[model samples]
Target: MEDGFNIGDIVLSKMGRDSGRHYIVVSTDENYVFICDGDYHKVAKPKKKKMKHVEATGSRSEYVAGKIAEEAKTTNTELRRAIAEFEGTENVPVQQDEM
Candidate 1:
């Protein structure tokens, strides 16, 4: 199986408070990737997590990939919508700040 992660790729968190959550890879380096779920981690502020901490789901979002490729502005709404579409859900509500 192709286990590599790329921009716009959906992943499942294997660790942390967000464990078992799905997120999109927004950025990456050799050892880490920045991920956002639109709910917990907004696209504007992705969370940098270790690559080993996430498991690649082998699914990708073309919309998110295009946005990342073009460096276009992304909002939480868009992220939520994309994720919801990928998950076959009606809609994904924005997460409230827990502070």
Candidate 2:
């Protein structure tokens, strides 16, 4: 069960009522990952999902990643925009760092 999940990475739910819904990876553990959509799943209360239950989308958010790596603060609005930017559903610009 190689999760291959990283903070700020985008993922898709594979096995649950939320299946097909895209979310952002906020945190991870040995066996599970915490995700937030910034709506139903807020950063204040992310959803804990099994690693195998999610499929990595190969997309990442540098802004959120930077905050986590720096131990700085991350907000739900940022998360929501990140998701929207990835899904191309919104025109909100996501600040991404070139790493």
Candidate 3:
């Protein structure tokens, strides 16, 4: 596993109010990182969390990295989709009610 996290890295919150939640690295500083889930924490309002509070999931989103590298605008839908894809839940069919 990588020792450090970079932009677009997927991480799981190990400690804090958002513990046990998954987030993507939106930005980072020397000791803190900005994370978002595209739901509670949107890209526009990424939560600033200590680096030690999150555990790297060892999975990364190249699509997100490319967008960040290109300085392109990202949306919450995209973030949610990326997370679902990474977790292998994107293809699961939603159950529909029989009316």
Candidate 4:
């Protein structure tokens, strides 16, 4: 967590293509913060010193909770698939290579 922003805090970007864009704080270093917007592909590491350009818009506790729930669902599904494979009832799911 940074001195000014906590992880999972929602914020609005004030500059760049992400200007006025809403994002959730994911991490912070001494001077920069990592954020994830609705678009996971749009994650950023912006400088805290320049954070004046950003505004704390809201809290992402609920959003985080939703993400946790989604992850749990995926994990459960994977476990079930694995069990099915072990029981010889289904083929194992393929693991795709990362691009």
Q: Rate the local accuracy (lDDT) of all candidates.
A: 0.82, 0.86, 0.84, 0.50
Please, what is the TM-score per model? 0.85, 0.86, 0.86, 0.49
Cα TM-score of candidate 3 = 0.86
Deviating ranges (above 4 Å) for candidate 2: 92-99
lDDT of 4: 0.50
Write model 4 residue lDDT over 1-99, tens digit each, in one string. 225876656676777776865655555666666665433223222334355656775555454535444653222233233334434556756443222
Residue pairs clashing in model 4 are none
After superposition, which runs of candidate 1 have C-alpha atoms over 4 Å from their true positions? 1-3, 91-99
Measured by lDDT, the strongest candidate is: 2
Predicted candidate 1 versus true structure: per-residue lDDT over 1-99, tens digit per residue: 223889999888999988998898899888899999877787767999999999988789888889889999877776777777777884546554433
Backbone clashes in each candidate structure, one number apiece? 0, 0, 0, 0
lDDT of 3 at 97: 22
Question: Counting only residues 3 or more apart in sequence or on different chains, how many pairs clash (N, Cα, C under 3 Å) in candidate 2?
Answer: 0
Lowest lDDT block of 10, candidate 3: 90-99
Give the range where candidate 2 is weakest over 10 consecutive residues by summed lDDT.
90-99
Ranking by lDDT: 2, 3, 1, 4
